[model samples]
Target: AVLGQRHEKNFRPIHYASKIITEAELNYTTTEKEMLAVVKVQLNELNELRDQAYENSLIYKEKTNRLHNSNIKDRVFNIGDRILLFNSRLKIFSGKLKSRWSGLFSISYVFPYGTVELSQPDEPSFKVNGHRLKHYFGGDRPKLVVPDLQTFPKDQ
Candidate 1:
């Protein structure tokens, strides 16, 4: 049986080809030859199913890639632009509330096909997938003001 994605909704079997194995086909094995003979048939039909599975898999892959790429915006970073790198391997034992991004890295170089070279202050530059990067707007800092003593409360 071969299954395929006819629509984006669900998977449905597109084709099914079956052949029952005979006694001669199961000549060697001492196991349940009766059941084996009734089941496997020839490798040819299985091979056809395998080929169909591969073709269907390719279609699924293409569709998945299309859907994924759709959500991705093309980002072009200039040299010295601040960016954050997403930690792709941080899934294990990590809380979802914690940030997976690990950079205040600057773009040292940009290349084709969503590849980037990033460098952090006092650290060596490294190449990473550009999909893992996003622009950084700098960290937040609060301003402090000193008031004159004349405006200060004397009760304390």
Candidate 2:
């Protein structure tokens, strides 16, 4: 009877231990599922935020393009107009006082898309971009006047 009582005591603990282990396993699986659900929600939110940022960047670029285009001044050229050509080659040298304009060229022909044919006296005519040319306001050269000096009378 004592051996029978001891056996009953050991079996009772083993059964209770198995039940506790199954409960713990169930709790762990539920916690893992909750964690996985939270991670998925966070991932979805991150993707949405990234998409919103991309859209905002595209909008910003479009506004910037429009503002830049609005500020640009259109240059117009016509035939027989005198223009000064900008000397881009002189930009390499450091000379603050030196004038970058080199030509008093006359526009012989005006082409589409900002192309212009320039002509100068005793020089071959060449084509250049209209952007490099500016209207020359100095029309005809001014004549200089010299004052006559008074002569002193010599004594005899």
Candidate 3:
């Protein structure tokens, strides 16, 4: 089905084309089926290259997504750790410019399957998805100081 974008950004069926496959063509492998379909459509060489390039770009996107996700370190939160919670629910007066994350909530309990119980000083505890929370550094710098490592350790 060929769809064209309409004025309201909705898709409209510009044209619809269909073809019946023969028994011999049905026997082709999945990869062969794709190439065969391109040929059966009688598209020009440029059109065929355009289609192939779209498919190749999709494969490249999948590979890049895998590599990008692999580089993201897993976040682990302890019971007492401070975290910021992501607000996914829309608010009536909240505009797009408003910050989505709202906390320095402390983790009181951690449940299985990425569920966490959070609480603040005067606020009641509430459960939220662990994926929505990120570690909060609380405006304090880490105390650990790195000693000079330029010289080799004294031969001890």
Candidate 4:
């Protein structure tokens, strides 16, 4: 309407609405949304997996330990109180008083037993921590299988 009014350009009317928009606020909201999607969610999943692995490890370790304390050395461990472990690498795992898998992992239950069982994070089978497995037991236990320790990274 104002553009159509040419000629002498007679003054019209004046009006103003109270409003505000901050560039900083808009940018901040955008940044926060991105961070939540990329960082917070991923971190939460990783932490949960780690915690579950730790819990599973404790359970597996404790159960296997019962066999140790049961005074059934001939049935569980033929090599006396010690156990030998052979990791996926075929490396011999040796330990002083238990299954070799116990030494390699601070949390042993995180390793997958097979592709079927390993598919889900919640059902992770016992895997030797690989790192510390050598301290307590050998690389070969009765039926336990662990991932490749040399290539595997420490859990987050």
Top candidate (TM-score) = 2
Residue 8 displacement (Å), model 2: 38
Task: Return model 4's CA RMSD, one decimal.
Answer: 23.5
- Pick out the ten consecutive residues of candidate 4 with the lowest summed lDDT: 112-121
Prediction 3 global C-alpha lDDT:
0.79
lDDT pick, better of 1 and 2: 2
- Compose the digit string of candidate 3's lDDT tens values, residues 1-156: 232336687756543336677899788876676666556455655688999999999999999999999999988888999898888774656697887778678999999888999998898999999999999886843445998778667886
Candidate 1 per-residue lDDT, tens place, 44-90, comes to 57888999999999999999999999998768788888898888788
Residue-wise C-alpha lDDT for candidate 2, range 59-150, written one tens digit per residue: 99999999999999887888889898999999999999998988688999999999999999899999999889999888763444788999
TM-score of 1: 0.44
TM-score order of candidates, top first: 2, 3, 1, 4
TM-score each candidate: 0.44, 0.64, 0.48, 0.28
* CA lDDT, candidate 3, residue 61: 100
Model 2 regions lying over 4 Å from their true place: 1-28, 138-156
Query: Which structure among the candidates has the greatest lDDT?
Result: 3
Give one digit per residue, the lDDT tens place, for model 4 in 1-156. Answer: 011223576643322222343565355564464443455456767999999999999999999999888975322211123322344533354544643232222232333332111112255444332332323344543545696767667899
